[model samples]
Target: MKRRTTERKMTDKERKFLVELLACTPSKFKRWMEGAQNALVLWAASMLGMVLGWLILAWLIHLLVNLEVGMRSPYALGVVSLLAPVCGLYAICSSVQWVRNWPDPSEALRQDISGGKVLDETYNVIEAKRFKEPEHGGLIYFLRMDDDRVLVIYDHESIALEMEGENALSSSFEPRRELHIVRAPSTEYILEQEFSGEKLELSAPVDLTVPPDQWPEQESWCEIPWLELERRLGMPGF
Candidate 1:
């Protein structure tokens, strides 16, 4: 085996630039990913169209002319063959869209937790267990916040706020004992008690050593606004 070489580290300027980039909302980042995936899916559907189109055109010609000896319907068959592929392409695209919109049972929790269009802000804590199957699983907390945001707290250091459009705002807090929070979603997500009719509360502070797979592992952590944090906690208004 070859010896591993030391990797070059980012300079201070490069690190600062990366931090600034991370602060930008993930809308564009996710859009680019979606676009790339769509292109691949369309390519696959087109190939499927070619095969299905051939069969459709062949069947139509067979029905119109019965495949009689020395009898061919080239002119009529040409038109049908050309249109068949277009129809197949349209059908595949429609089917793909319908399937994507279909509700998935296994993804229900994740969909709600991630703030999808049909986000289920309300859910009973079915069973919360820390398992290593999902790559040394971390502590995961399920919460239905007052503002209809379903938060999945992975650990004390990081949390994921499910947002609309199958996206999540993954954030890290300053790893301090002091609790913090923002009024709404932001680049950094801090832990705090939001006013709730349900009176939700954590059993205790959860600590995990490893970050979950979905959480964006970042080097920098942002602190919430001091005033907003105080307001949410019901401290004396300034």
Candidate 2:
């Protein structure tokens, strides 16, 4: 006999939140690097093997033919010397790309938690509209409180929020996406939230510490083009 399992459907609010989260896309560098990550690794390995194979073949050619004569000829030596560095450089590049594309530990954990139900503690009730740029294809929740700092949050597959100049917090929202914390940003030191899995991980790095109190008050901040912000921050564009 097989065990029976009952699955409940998500409520309307949950479904809407999920749709928004699913629409957000990762940075361009991530897309490019992850596109052929596995294939790139194999290519790098094959190229290294080819280099070793060529070295062995050169030795055999020297033994079987007038290899000393070829080595003595400046033209033959020049061709060999030129090709060696080119092949070496290509191999080095491919290897670096493979490592750079490796998955982040924090991101991997977030994906895992997405399978479970989102805890009730995630939602923040304030109606303050954070940066809402429909053209950018996403909206971020920006907030300011008692302290001289700002809180920026957004919903992806997981809940990603950061306190400028402080630390970031990311949690899986299997059932819902919300910010439950009410405390304002700290003025003296950075505040952080730690999970059993790993620290906060984001597509782009941000320094909330500098000008930590500069929270966007007017809707004008939303008007600033998304690509422009990405460019200014030295982050990958769409």
Candidate 3:
């Protein structure tokens, strides 16, 4: 049998850095999460688009009835009918695209959610128990650094889970409970840095004990689904 060898640790400064990182998180990530949750709303909107498109098409016909209604042909109706679904898909895609390119966290929330703070304080890694699922895709994080631009850790790989099928993302990326936030007026110069090295720019490396106990464990050893679990926990404004 093989035995474990060494444990990882972080310096005091890194620990403190993470404490500040969790503070400035954008609320847009939370909105993307809730949107994923109420997929029912997305689906409903798609269906509504279809119905609305059909109604508009019908109205176009009625207006045409006044102009050329007496000599109308099937070709015009067919052309309009064909265009309706394209418009419907466009509407759905347009509505959901911002779920990805949320320009600013505050802007996304202002239109979607009410009475939520743009940035909130937090102090517990174990508190991130919401984002623990296979179906959920990856999203953003608000890590803090000494530099001006924040870091963006991309986990674009795929995962095969025990209960579910293939997941395009697989990493244990729970944000350390340290963050600091800038106000809307000061957000003009905010930046993001992508991680290209071996490990994430965590304020401190994760504790081994907490992941197993608080996170959902699958048969696989390499993957850690953090955001999915954290989102579900409805991680409070902390």
Question: Whole-model Cα lDDT per candidate?
Answer: 0.36, 0.37, 0.37
How would you encode candidate 3's per-residue C-alpha lDDT over 114-213 as one tens digit per residue?
2222222122122212222223333233333332223333233322232245533344443443332221122221222122223333332221223334
lDDT string for model 1 (63-167, tens) is 898763211445556655665566566656655675565433333223322331211112232222111112332234433322332334444322223222221
In the range 72-107, model 2's lDDT, one tens digit per residue, is: 445556656665666556755765675566433334
Q: Is candidate 1 or candidate 2 better by TM-score?
A: 1
Clashes of 2: 9
lDDT for position 233 in model 1: 23
Evaluate model 2: give its lDDT: 0.37
Candidate number of the best TM-score: 1
Q: Is candidate 2 or candidate 3 better by TM-score?
A: 2
Question: What lDDT score is found at residue 207 in candidate 2?
Answer: 21
